[model samples]
Target: MMGESNRTTEIPCEFYSDKYPDPSNHPITIVLFTLLYTFVFLISFAGNMGVIYATIRHRSLQTVQNIFIVNLAISGVILACLSIPLTPVTHIAKQWFFGSLLCRVVGGTQAIGTFIGTFSLCAIAVDRYFRLVIAPGRPLRKVNAMRITMIMWAVSIVVTLPYVYHMNLMKYSPKHGLCGWFCTEKWPSPFSKRAYTIFVLVIQFLIPFSIMTVCYHAIFSFLRKRAKTRLTSIAQQANLLYVLAATAGRETQQHKEQMTHLLDQKKRVVAQKRRVTLILVSMVFIFGITSLPHNFVSTLMEFTDSRDLLTFYKTDYTYIVSLLTHLVGNEPDTTVAPFASLQPLHSFVNRYHSAVIPCANFETVFIWYINEYSGQFSSLAMLSCVTNPLLYAFLNPEFRELVLNGLAGVSWANNFVSKSWHPTQTTVL
Candidate 1:
């Protein structure tokens, strides 16, 4: 039903006819997907948990930016725990086994996490811009950061309510007479569905992307301008010192030492500014790359008819050829009967067996292939959860120290962390 139709009316489970078996059902595919999902879960969960634990355990790590990072880590943990585990199962089974209550809860939780993460990123960008550009050296207060975090959660929850309400568990009987259930959105009308889709696209992607872009651009420009001015002033001072030394006929050791110190200081300042800019830019770029694909697919699905989508994919020679080759080579027996071992349903099977035969056609296979891969692409958005923690660990040295110190109770980890510890340098940017 998910990939087959976009209409509000109930569709029969024949929409998922076994004739067009899901590609994800292949044994190798299932195993690979399982491993991938497991890795994502472990990394995202453990990494984000570490961030949260460090922030809570160490007052020194509880800065304004780290507050937003903690919020993001919380969202990542939610996604890893609630969403990633169910993704592969749903794709392979092409059904929702977790009933109606879970359907609503999981759907709502996903939306809330997405909203909170997006908002937190924007908040971080704004905080950085204000600290660096608007009021240099004055960081946001922890109390205000806490208030902003609360507001973000509240707004995210409110915006996700309608989406949760529309998450329906639809049950229908396939031609094989077996009842199947799937969780999907059941909007009152097509207009409402499109409206909500557009609303989410705007709130989740457009506004936040624009905000990050503008804020980061302004911050970069400000830093570049300030750095250029400082460098020019330093160069002038060096020239004046050189003239003085030449006129005096001898350069004093103190003057040479002072010149060298100023140059070193300028280099450090420039390097620090560049590092900060690069980290923020990388964060913004990764967010866009991971978010755009899922949003684009959603837009296409909502705006175009299923038949149109099928037709579009049908025209793709590569997908059709590859799908055919894979099915033909891997699945030699395409005519395998549906639920062949269920002897109790023999009469029912005989009655409607012919109904299931039509689905073996080319169009059904193409549709299944398209939907399977689209769902796979949509899952890529979850990579943001993985990437966020990794970025923090690698780019933010102070946070990394906090995480390592938190793990210092373990023998091997403590040895490694102690060897790497350098508290005097403060490489936070």
Candidate 2:
């Protein structure tokens, strides 16, 4: 028993046992997580596939911007198919059932998807900025967009190779378990891990995020200035028409009507432009917000030692108080030992030792905290896959129309099936 308990204390935080309840194992949690993952998968897969299908079927939809949109959709589809489904399973089961090859494949695919998505967003922003602000009449060519997308894919794959190389499936024994397995990166050294984490964080997230922010900010500024100038010009034209109305009666009235129509058209154009800009800005904002938590946690884990974090958590009196309240309650039962009022405190210490101390050394506590809590945040990051389709494809008027039309056309198959199953009656009755 002593040997078993000692071994249990030595077990890594990644594996769970009876002493540490696996929250993911709860019936309610399992149901909710399953539902959420399924919802994200279906939406992402169907939405992105629709975008790709629409672009392929209709040549008109194959513009430069649509090209990048298609790329983004491809990335979303990849993540939906590969990453999201398996992620929750690993967390819930506290094991990696997939073998060594799949561990690398899945990890590589996820990294590729993330990089492609981020790069595509940046590319779209830069393309839009150039089209609107740099040269209004000269838009990016479809060929150029295709080249850019291919470059993004190549770069994403190249950068992700290192991660795939480091990824490994290793087996371990959890408390009360014969054997368990997990998939994780086993870097050559601490410095290598830190370097890779920093590299990925900066290249995949920070740089692309910075680029998108700058481009979109400039685009918004340009649109606002352009709208103001156009509105001013329209007002001036209206005043001129009003002034000329007195000199030439019938002809001036006709001219004023034309000016009114033109003014309305300009207003509509400005409003449309503002809406598009707002949607694009929201996409960037959402991307940053969703991705930040994952990146921050990764960086913290890489750069900071677990011992440091444990020390901080331990020394922070507020944290201790909150933890105690959470573990015990606001008040303890003095009646448990009437003669020894400190019995409750002693019990609390014993419970803490049995529950936490044995299962959680400083490093174990830190890893457990991350595995338990940060996994929730990681789900938020995956949710960006679902949001990409909504923000980039479904929300865009042209893309939405094309997708709807394509879906409407798919009813032919249903019609044929219905005809075959239930023959129509065309009698005079």
Candidate 3:
């Protein structure tokens, strides 16, 4: 198998591409990129940690929605610390410096974090849809919430196992010179890689996105119907003739108070529903928008012809020679000078690299784009991580109150907000 798989000995073509920034030659590019990624990591870490701490410390914020929020925060924290931070290093470095083991670990952790986050958002959407539309007045139990959260994490891990299984750490050969360490999949076949790409794109993203869309639409429809019904019922009740003498003294006073309480309760429920819906919708929107391009590009790449996409360089003769002599079982043409810059090396690598290993499909324009913009997209996605805590704080008054009250103990500055505060039950807008 090792002899059969020797085709990876081809010189690394990526380093020769003008698309990637040469940090050695352009040091400022590395600095700017590093600063950006570092900012994302710090902000994401702090925001997610704040959310987890706030959710756990506040009794009023322990609803099922908050549970999902906390779980997603955990995922975000992992992304910030484990997965996301590594992106800067990859972007600046000449090649994948990490060994095969760390490669799998990092790649797998990233996949896990992404899947869990995406699914957690979907779960929140589903929960809201059910609560407001399907099972109004029935609260989700803590036990059941815990069960669902566990299931989400479990499924995410299982679904992303391919990232770990196929990831290989490749070292640059002497002939390849300074290509450095790179991690890529060594899939057994091109079809397998394409299948997996499509599978992940569809299952993890497209399906969840569709589900959220449908759930939100249904929830909105239900809310609109209820609003219209309530307005109509109020108009009808107002039109009904009622004699003032019918319910004279004591009973009338008690009835008026009872009606007031009921109206206030209904108002509170409606406000809470609206606020919760808004928060979830915002989350779904941000996630869907930021993640859509990456998934679409990846899925689209599966259909692209890698032969036409890769750029060949003068240094790729080792790969071309090995391909023609070993795999093609053809005599080397003495007419062509060795190591001469040629275009056919690109074709040779694309044609037979898959036969040698599983991950040849990664050599495409899509992968090139991903490598180039990885930091940018990662930063974009992590922007959502920080925004989530802020969203909850703004949307849920109870959460905002808790955060403020927690801030109230520090100094005169803290006391200022504390003085202005009055405790109130959770009321949604």
Cα shift from native, residue 401, model 1 (Å): 0.9
lDDT of 3 by residue, 1-429 (tens): 787678765544444323333322256645655565566567777778877877889787888888988888887786667644454344334345566667677667666777777787788778877887778789688899999999998998887776467666654333433344455555677777657656776776688899888887787677667665765665454333133325453346655665566566556546645654675567668767656644553344335534322234622232222222211111011111111101111111111123223122334423333222211222235556667667644345556655655645456535544453333222221
Candidates in order have lDDT scores of 0.60, 0.57, 0.53
* Candidate achieving the largest lDDT: 1
In candidate 3, which residue pairs clash?
A: 96-181, 186-358, 187-358, 187-359, 188-358, 271-428
lDDT of 2 by residue, 1-429 (tens): 999988777844344433344344567866876776677668768888988999899897788888998998888787677655665565455456778777677667766777787888889888877987788789988888888998999998998777667555654434433245555554556566556656776886789889988987887777667667877887887777767875666556588677879787576757656675667578678777766655665455444434333234334221222122211211111101001101111111111111112222444533433322221222344556666777776665555666776788675534433232211110000
**Descending-lDDT candidate ranking:** 1, 2, 3
Instruction: Please identify model 3 stretches exceeding 4 Å from their true place.
Output: 1-25, 227-281, 306-380, 392-394, 411-429
The sequence of per-residue lDDT tens digits that candidate 1 reaches over residues 28-98 is 87686677667767877888999899889889887888899899988888767766666445545555678
lDDT, candidate 2, equals 0.57
- Name the 10 consecutive residues with the lowest summed lDDT in model 3: 332-341
What's the lDDT for residue 273 in model 1? Answer: 68
- Give candidate 2's root-mean-square deviation (CA, Å): 13.4
Instruction: Name the candidate, 1 or 3, with the larger TM-score value.
Output: 1
Model 1 segments more than 4 A misplaced: 1-18, 137-139, 176-179, 248-256, 306-376, 392-394, 410-429
